[model samples]
Target: MIAATRELPAAGYAPEVDGRLKAEFTTRLRQAGGEELKRRFPMLRIRIYDAQTHAREEI
Candidate 1:
C-alpha cells in the first residue's frame, strides 16, 4: 500500500470540492503511467489524503 497526502489551498477546503479534485487526481494517476506499476504490482493499494479536511480515501 502506498500512502500519500496532498495539501489543498483554501479553495479546496470544502469537502465536495476537495473530493472532486481528489477523484480527478486519482483518475489521472491511474491513467497516466500507472499502468506499468499496476501490471507489476497487481495487489498495490493507494491511500490518498486531503490535508485541509483531514479526509482519507483508499483507491
Candidate 2:
C-alpha cells in the first residue's frame, strides 16, 4: 500500500480510495491472522484523521 500512497504527493487522498484501501487492508489483516503474526496487526477499528482540518473518520 505504500506504493499506492506514494503515488500521491500530499498528506491525504480521495475518500473513496481511502475507504476501499481500508476495507481491503482490514480484510487481509483478519485473513492472515496466524499464530506467528499475532498482535502484529491489531486493528480493532480503522480511523483516518485530517491533521490540517482536525477532522476524523471511522471506517
Candidate 3:
C-alpha cells in the first residue's frame, strides 16, 4: 500500500488512488478484529470522529 501511495508522486489517476487504498485498508482492518489490531499494531492509532453519523468509519 505504501508503494502505491509513493507512486502518487510519479503518476496520476483521474478517479484518485486514495479510494482504492481506503477500501483495502478497511477490509484488512475488518479482518484483523479489534483485539488483534490493538496487540499487533500498538503504536498505530485510529479514531473515528463520525462513529455514529457516517455510514462507515473513516479509519
Candidate 4:
C-alpha cells in the first residue's frame, strides 16, 4: 500500500480531488516505469488517508 499524505484543500475531499490525484499518480507511475518504479517500490496499490476525518480512499 502506498499512502500519500496531502493537506486538505479549503473545499476538502471532493470527488474531483480524488480523480485528479489518481490521474496524477498514474502519470507519475508511468514516468517511473520499469526499473525506476518496479525495482524500487514494487507497489501496485495506492491509497489516500485523511487523518482528521479518518477517511480512506483506494486508488
Per-candidate TM-score against the hidden true structure: 0.32, 0.27, 0.27, 0.27
* Arranged by lDDT, best first: 1, 4, 2, 3
How well is each residue in 1-59 modelled by candidate 4, as lDDT tens digits?
98776444432332223233332222223333323433465564444434346465554
TM-score (C-alpha, index-matched) for candidate 4: 0.27
Candidate 3 backbone collisions, by pair? none
Question: What C-alpha lDDT do the candidate models reach, one value each?
Answer: 0.43, 0.35, 0.32, 0.39
Worst 10 residues of 2 by lDDT: 22-31
Looking at model 2, residue 28 earns an lDDT score of: 22
Best by lDDT: 1
Residue 27, model 4, lDDT: 23
Clashes of each: 0, 0, 0, 0
* Model 4 bad stretches (over 4 Å): 1-43
Candidate 2 TM-score, true structure as reference: 0.27
- Deviating ranges (above 4 Å) for candidate 2: 1-43
Model 1 agreement with the true structure over 1-59: per-residue lDDT tens digits: 97575445342222222233333232224334344545676676544444456664554
